[model samples]
Each structure stands twice: as structure tokens, then as C-alpha cells.
Target: MNKQKIAVLGPGSWGTALSQVLNDNGHEVRIWGNVPEQIDEINQFHTNKRYFKDIVLDPAIKAYKELSEALDGVDAVLLVVPTKVMRLVAKQVAETLDHKVVVMHASKGLEPESHKRLSTVLEEEIPAALRSEVVVVSGPSHAEETIIRDLTLISAASKDMETAQYVQTLFSNHYFRLYTNNDVIGVETAGALKNIIAVGAGALHGLGYGDNAKAAIIARGLTEITRLGVEMGANPLTYSGLSGVGDLIVTGTSVHSRNWRAGDQLGRGEKLEDIERNMGMVIEGISTTKVAYELAQELGVYMPITQAIYSVIYQGASIEEAIKHIMSSEFRQENEWS
Candidate 1:
């Protein structure tokens, strides 16, 4: 594989982890973040203590406080920032970009205001002259595990197959494997919507529900995700792939998931503000639940699980009541469309 110079924005857990992956692949990785102290630590000590407490990053991985310095002459750019700041960061990158680069995002979210996918957000913010077709890199992999060089499989998806394969080559390595897919919509939809189910699953565990309930949440939550994804023009089969069910399994079950952790805190009677404040990171599902709830309503899709989570986060509904609301809803055929 040819060594490429890559710019990674965010410098958070996911961004730091991916930069390490690129460094491992013998690529020149330049990381950009807003925090001066974090950038200093990474550049001076080769560690981002705020995210990885024990791990020391490769000395070759450089961190820059200035966005332009990071983007200077990079072949590709990876965006791993929070969805909330995706547009702002993309716009900044657009302004700094001098040549065409393949843009990829690892964030899993919909814009709450526009209810649009992050890829769409990038497409709108970055001019076509500055970037190729946007690619979505998503799946079951978490930054904590991935940073440790754990065996992980993820999708590199885009409407353009060549571009997807191009990204597939850019990041794939021995431990970090990338599979190419042409279903951009399905891949992105699954990546973002799974966080909602993860929150609900975490809430189920916090509520003292047993495996049966969590299993039900995973299974039924997938149905809700698939239903909404389909309504949003995603292929049904794509939901069964890594970006869909695979992502849902990891996020909904793992303690490493911020969305799940947030839901768990809520189930334990913690306030949303307190949970957000304590995590010190973005729990995307909280906002995603609201966006999914609104999208389901607008698309006339039935998503009780999303509504339950939304009720808990936005409407101040009790966990027990939310679960009760879901359980008490009228039953439908196992395969209604069939």
C-alpha cells in the first residue's frame, strides 16, 4: 500500500484512534483539535491523556492546533468529530482546502435541525471542487477497542463504488479491516439510528431488566431502525450488514458506548444535563432519539422504541413508564408487509 498523508479532524477518542491506525499503516497522520493543551500533549508527549489514559501514541503522529496546518497538502481527510459540530468543522476544512481530497466521516448522527445525515451535511458545506464523493466509515468498532489495535471490521460505504474502494484501501490493515459497500444511505442510516437502540438497551439494563428484555430491545429496536431506514430510501438488506445490525449489537450492549451509558444513567434517575456534564463527551443518541422520533412521525413510520427513548429524554417520562408504554402498544403482524 502506498503511504499517504492524511489529516484527521476532532482529535477525540475516535479521531485519535484512527490516527494511530493510519500511523500503523505507515501513513503520515496530522491530527487537528481545538484544545491547545490536548494538541500540546499529543505533540510533546505522544499521548492524549483526556481520551486514552494508558496508551502512548506513535511519535510519528503529529497534532496541530491550527486547522490549516493539519490540512496542508493532505491526500485525504477523516472527520471523526461530534455530529453537532460536523457542519462547522466541514466548513472550516472547506475554506482551508486547496485541492481535491476524499472526505470520510466516522460520526453517527443526523442534524437535529434539518434531520439530514452527516454525509449530506458535508456535501452541502464542502464544495465539490474541494472534495470527492463523501464516504461513511462506520460499524461495530469503538475507539477504545480500536485504539488498542483490536480486531475490528467496518464498512467503507459510498454511492460511488470506486470511491468506497479507494477508502477501503486507505484505512484497511491487518487488525483494522474495511469492507466496501455501495449503500451510502443504508450505511449512514444504520450507523446513526443504532445509537437510539443502544440508549434504550442501556436503559433496560439500568431498569433491572434481564437478558430477555435486552435481547428483545436489540431485536425489536432493529426492526424500528430498519423500518425508518427503508422509509428514508435505504435498501432493506443493508440493515443486515455491518453498518446496521453489527453496529447496533456493539453500541447497544457495550459499556464503552456513550449513548448506552447515558441511557443507563437516565434509567438510574440521573438528569440529562448531569449525564452530559459528567460524560465530558457527546452522547449522540440523546439528540438522535429526538431526530429519529421526528423523522418517524414525518415519514409515518411506526417506531415505539424510539418514541420510548424520546419520551424519557425529552418528555421527562420515567423509565418504567416508557418501557410500559412500549409493551402496552398494540401488536402487529410479525411481517406485516408480507
Candidate 2:
């Protein structure tokens, strides 16, 4: 394997775990955090206090407070910050680095108001030269389990097969595997849309729905995503890949998924405001619900599940009302669109 200096930026759990993976791969790893205290903690105790607590980070990974110091000798960058913080983080990195980097993002979201995917935002904010190097890596992996070296699967999506291949090698380890895909748009859209649907699934599950009901909701949710993605010219096969159903399955069921947890609270009669105050971290689905709802409307696609999620999260609509709306309005045949 070609050894390249890797810099994992972001002080979050996912970023720290990925950096630890690179450190284990025998590559030079430099981690950069926007916070000074996080930098001090990582360098001193080799653990992230706020994020991945108790998990000892790799000794090979060095921490840097300054963004420039992290990017200085790095060959590639793994951008794992949350969706909302992505642009600011990219802008900071762009100031110090000019070369084409193998930029990979683990964030699965679109800017809520702008309705732009993370890759699109990165392409616009980061230089065009770096745009060609930009790649989206997403899949079923959750940071909590990955920290313990659990088996996980992810896809490297980029226009350039060689770039995807390089990223595949860049992240692959014994307990983690990477796959490559050229359907960058589809992979990215699936990654984002699944989070939106996972919230709906969690809400349904928390509402005392049976396995059959949950399965039906998930199937229909996927159909909604496929409709929107297909309208945007994304290959249907891409939506069926790891970045799609694989991610959806994990996010919908895993207790560690912030989106799922938030949805559960909503279903159990907790208000969105209270959930947000408690989470402290970003529950991306709450933000993504708005985008998916608006995009489906703008694209003239039928996304009832996304609409329900949006109404409950943003429109001040009641959870019971959202359920009533979905159950009463639809009596269509299965696979009717096909």
C-alpha cells in the first residue's frame, strides 16, 4: 500500500476513530480540532473527552490546534465534521492548503435552507482543483462501535475510480472494509436521505408499531428517496448500495444513532425543543427533514414520509397528527410507481 500522510480534521467521535484507524495503518496521522482544549486533551491523554470517551486514541496520531499545522505535511484529508459545521471547517482548511487533496467526508446531510449536499457545498467552497479530489465516504458505520474496532462497511464515491480506489486503501483496515463507487451523486444523496427516513422509522418504532408496520414504513421511505434521486438523474442501483439501504438499516435501528434517538423521543411524546436542548450534539435528521421535504416538493416527487417528519419537526405539528395524516391519506398499491 502506498503510504500517504493523512490528516483527520474534526474533534468528533467519528473523526477521532478514523484518525486512530489511520494511525493503526502505519501512516503518519495528524488530527486537527477547531477547539484548543480538544487539541490539548488528545495530545496529553490520547482520548477525546467530549466525544469518544474512555477510548484511547492511537499514539501514532498527533494532535494539532492550528489548522495549518495539521495540513502542512498531510497528503489527504478526511473531513468528518457534522453537516452544519462542514463549510466553516472547509474554509479554514482552504486558507492553509492549496494542493488537490483526497477530501473525504463522513457527514450525511444537505444544508437545511440551501438544500445543497455536503459534496456540492464542498465543491463550491473549496477550490475547483480540490473539487476533482473531493470524495464522499459513507456507509453503515457508527462512531461508537468503530472506536472498539468493530466490523464496518463504507463506500468511496467519486467520479475518478483511481481516486475512489486510493480512498478505499486509505481507510481499509482488518476490522473495517471499503468499497469503491463512481456514482458520487447517488451515493451522497442516499447517505443524506436515509437519515431523514431513519428518523421516521424510529418514530414509528417508538409509537409501539409492530415489525410489519416498521418494515412497511422503511420500504415506503426508500421508495420516496428513490423517486427523488431518480428524478435528479441518479442511478437506481446506487440507491440500493451500501450508502443507501445499508446506512438506512443501521441508522434506523442503532441506539447510538442521534437521529434515531431524537425521533424516538418525539414519538414518545417529547417535544422537538426539549430533545434538541438535551442532545447538545446535532441530530442531523431534524435539519435534513426540512431539506428533504422541500426538495421533494421542488422536484415534484411524492415523499409522504419526509413530509410527515418535516411537519412534526419544523411545522409545530403534533406527532399524533402526523401519524393520522400518513395512515388516513394513503391507500395506494405497493410498487404503484413502478
Instruction: Compare the candidates by TM-score and give the number of the best one.
Output: 1
Model 1 clash pairs are none
TM-score of 1: 0.98
lDDT (10s digit) by residue, model 1, range 1-338? 68899999989899899899889989999999999999999989999888899999989999998988888989999999988899999999998999999899999999988999999999999999999999999999899999999999999999888888988888888999999988888999999999999999998887788899889999988888999998888999989989999999999999999988988888888888999999999989988999999999899998888998888888878989987887787878877631
> Per-residue CA lDDT of candidate 2, range 1-338, in tens?
76789888877878887887777778898988778888898888888878775788776688988788888867888888888888888888777796777788888888767888888788878897754557888988898998899998999988889988988898898988999998877888888888888888788777888788778777888888888888877889987889888888888877898888888888888878899899877888888878888888888898888888888887888877988898999488877653
Question: Weakest 10 consecutive residues, lDDT, candidate 2?
Answer: 124-133
| Candidate 1 ranges beyond 4 A from true positions | none
Alpha-carbon shift of residue 297 in model 2 (angstroms) = 1.0
Model 2 earns a TM-score of 0.96
TM-score of each: 0.98, 0.96
What lDDT does model 2 reach? 0.83
The lDDT leader among the candidates is: 1
